[model samples]
Target: MLRQDLAAIVRAGFSAAAAGRLLERALAPGDALPDGALRVIAAGKASSSMAEAARGLLGSRIRGGLVVSPEPRSVPSPFEAIAGGHPMPTTGSEQAGRRALALAASLQADETLVVLLSGGASALMAVPAAGVALDDKRATTDRLLRAGADIHALNTVRKHLSAIKGGWLAASAPCACRAFAISDVVGDDLSVIASGPTVADSSTFSEAADVLRRFGEEAAYPGAVVARLAKGARGDVPETPKPGDPRLVRAASAVIGGRRDAMDGAAREAGTLGYHVVWIDDPVVGEARIAALLHLRGVVARADGVARPTCIVSSGETTVRVIGDGKGGRNQEFALALAAPLASLGGAAAAASAGTDGIDGPTDAAGAVVDQTTVERARAAGLSPDTFLDHNNAYAFYNNAYAFFAALGDLILTGPTDTNVGDLQIILLA
Candidate 1:
């Protein structure tokens, strides 16, 4: 029963249908468009759905389009769909990037270009700047991911290394352009969302270099990448367009969906389930395990204050600094860390943490669920959560625990949710 309720809550929170509706509302009719052809370029996990919404609204106006996603999905005939890579850029991603650039360049000054940007666009539409090999870019991205860099830091570096990111895509187009984004980063900063392909970038090459130095990964970066950043910082290479640049005068962007929308959806579902809802307004950030403990403390406090059943919902992306060679994502680590504290809460508490996109880190599982029985079940199976967590293997821990505690329904699996809004977490006290 607990598992069902939690799943329902998560589903309510990240429904692709709901996201499509929200996108439709954000791009409702009467939004001004230049009196010419409309070309669409959609990229990221939510690209297909966002394109579909755009099609519904501006069907006849959309002349041709392209969408780049981690996997192919059915899209309108006018829009060519290509499968790209995520977490790392692949040859297909390079091809998609080239196609996007060509499409953008094809636009006349009288035409309009609509870019649907969302999470995963950074890798899905990879286009390295001159002199940076794809392999080098991939290696740099891998190092950054392993080093547990936040999205902002990751995009800061990515924008500098890319030919089409950080407003370059917008600059290439002579036509009027607008980008609608489903932000996965904290604060919904346009410059960081999918590297802000159609928006002006305020970050600089020097700042990108600083991010590498701050993360202690500067030495590990590919030599060519380091050289490129250094050159750009020294003004040997042009910087990404900044605010008020003429290249960005015709470009505009709006965030159509994000963490706040997902949180509200979850809150409404919790209330409908007869639980008093407490919304955690602060965005959850930092190391996954530490954030888990902090979130547990908040849950306990809320539980103490309420007489009736209560539900707590919080949203934000968290990082897992990879000290352990374990195979898990931030959401998995978070759920694992919560097990002990939740077990201490006695029998009336259950909690869940999951990525809204349905895939957490490199693992197939979105995240995990835990209750008082989780820790006990692990013991019965001769499993040590600490040992698994120490190895950074939350996926293995949950996989083993799920085998022993099948009734607990600990693994939350929703394949390729096709939308990203960071992550959503819920704690229920009854």
Candidate 2:
């Protein structure tokens, strides 16, 4: 029940009212647009909710806008909403990217362009650089991701390959551009969020090429992508907008919400549920399975002499190497990895790791949870935890265990929170 309550807390923190509250705060320091002509461009997983909040706040002040999201617009929206691809760009993504550039280019000196950015915008808006085909760009991005390159390396490559990313979109506007982002990355890097369309980029073309080479996949990328990077490195093409560029003088941005907010929400719910909340301040990082092992060792030792029931909570994203042909995201893997160690606790304790956005990788479920009995229950159902972990098929294990795992926190399946803030983990112990 605590696990289910944690899911509800995540939903509440996903923020309809909280988004408005944030926008109201974000508007305080910015200069007003006297022309009453506000143009809003929202992109990524939380694009629709953020756009709606902006509309509610700006009202008649907003003259026009665009929303690029992974899902189709539900209709009756004031902005030109396009259903864009995520994790990969589609034709709709290309259309949205082109229109975004045109929209920024059309802005006058007195007008304002508000960019609502979040996670997935990098793929949701992909306008390749000159001479680079979208397919080539897509292929390159896929290779980088599959290589398990970190976000810094990923965005370095992404910014260099695209025309709209890395502050180019903001530079195109003659008017003031302000961005409000729901950060989904650790450390809330402004330049990494949505590839920083409204923030100056410090990455160089040479650095982008280095990322591909560092991952040993430089030659694996499509030819056009490889050629473009080489050209930029050789000074044949211009670099992304750098800091202090005159064009970006009027551009500014802020992180409105993120994983920290979700983390705090979980802590609050735990406290309300009558447990002493203990926070795991360090961000969850590295391979999902390894991280799970470390957490188990640390927390289980700490639970030895607790006088009160406790809720241990932490947040951050972890990566998966994906060596096998299995179906699972990092969160699912994290939770599944805990089953073995958690059984050692020998109490009514449960732990869960889930994406705040409620979608894990390519699967329909958000993530999974495991208790002391999870391993025993799964084995009774004719499953092998080690075998699943070996194949990296955490999702399949959880799915196959569904019949026997009912109400044991098997999944946290909150569909489309319309927000992204990384992932969360909660462990309740007595």
Candidate 3:
């Protein structure tokens, strides 16, 4: 019997949301000096929500501000909200970028600047550098994403080509900037948060060029972008401000949430469900399939060693090298791969993988869950897990079992959750 506990599923789905709430709780009015004259500026996937949180803390004292974020513009925030394109820069994103830069440039020395940053900020809050067009930036971003470039590499190139990223916004603002960030990348490197608009950058132009060349995407990127890097590498264009630079002297940054937060909550919930909890690690980044394979091997080993009910918990962003035109994200891909390996073990325990953010890759569902019987069920339905895994079509495979696997409510969902820490995977070896 494939017993589905709707409440448990909902609990798992809401765990990430609970983590997001915890992040917002860490922000206090005392964190930022209540000078009644701070100019708020934020950008990223969660920038809007973070801005809203700050606004609630600041109340009517805010001296006006601007936020650049993905569109289908969020509800009227206390401050001005400007929606922009994401994963790729568009004309609207360019306009929002200008507005953000203008807002930063207008800040006075006496005015404190509050910056809210999160993932997706790089593409959403894009401001093209000199001689770079929006179309060119979009094309370059598309190429990098398709080539399976990791987040760090993609953002490195993005920062160098942007007018606002790589600490330009901080440099533009004369006011002392205080950054409140939601970290999405592993290690929580500030430079990776929305490409580090308010924080100092350590990446060099030559490194940016190297990433493109290594990915075989050098030719796909704009010639102008490449030329600019070459010039910057030769010292014509100034490097980004490093740590301890005078510009960063008055700046402040804090990470309120991350992958571990989600993972911890999920582990707790699994324990409550009568499973022996096993916490792996949070923010486990790398190739999705390999991670899945390793996880399966561990689960199989553990299952063989004990008769006690057990569950394994892990969190991290995984990458999928798109070899074909397929529809799926890392979490989905991971789940599909796990199903293949778990099929060899055979049993009734269920394993579910999900993105803490709810939306995994371009798919609507957060991820998928499969039991030992799922493979035979899939085979009976004429669905070949191995065949689809090769094509990166996990979404399609799960869609066929939507009644079961896809019913898992997403932790990442609509409405601003005010956070982005990455994915969380849980395997209940009952």
Record all residue pairs in model 2 with backbone atoms less than 3 Å apart, i.e. clashing.
none
Q: For residue 255, give model 2's deviation from the true position in Å.
A: 0.7
Error of 3 at 298 (Å): 3.5
Model 2 score (lDDT) = 0.82
User: Could you give candidate 2's per-residue lDDT for residues 5-26 as a string of tens digits?
Assistant: 6555555444422444555566
The number of the candidate with the highest TM-score is 1
Question: TM-scores, in order shown?
Answer: 0.97, 0.94, 0.90
Relative to the true structure, candidate 3 reaches a TM of 0.90
What is candidate 3's CA lDDT for residue 159?
86
Compared with the true structure, model 1 gives a TM-score of 0.97
| Candidate 3 lDDT over residue span 247-324, tens digit each | 777777777677676766676776677777776753557788888887777656655655457767777788888886
Candidate 2: deviation at residue 140, Å? 1.8
Overall lDDT per candidate, in order of appearance: 0.87, 0.82, 0.72
Winning model by lDDT: 1
Ranking by TM-score: 1, 2, 3
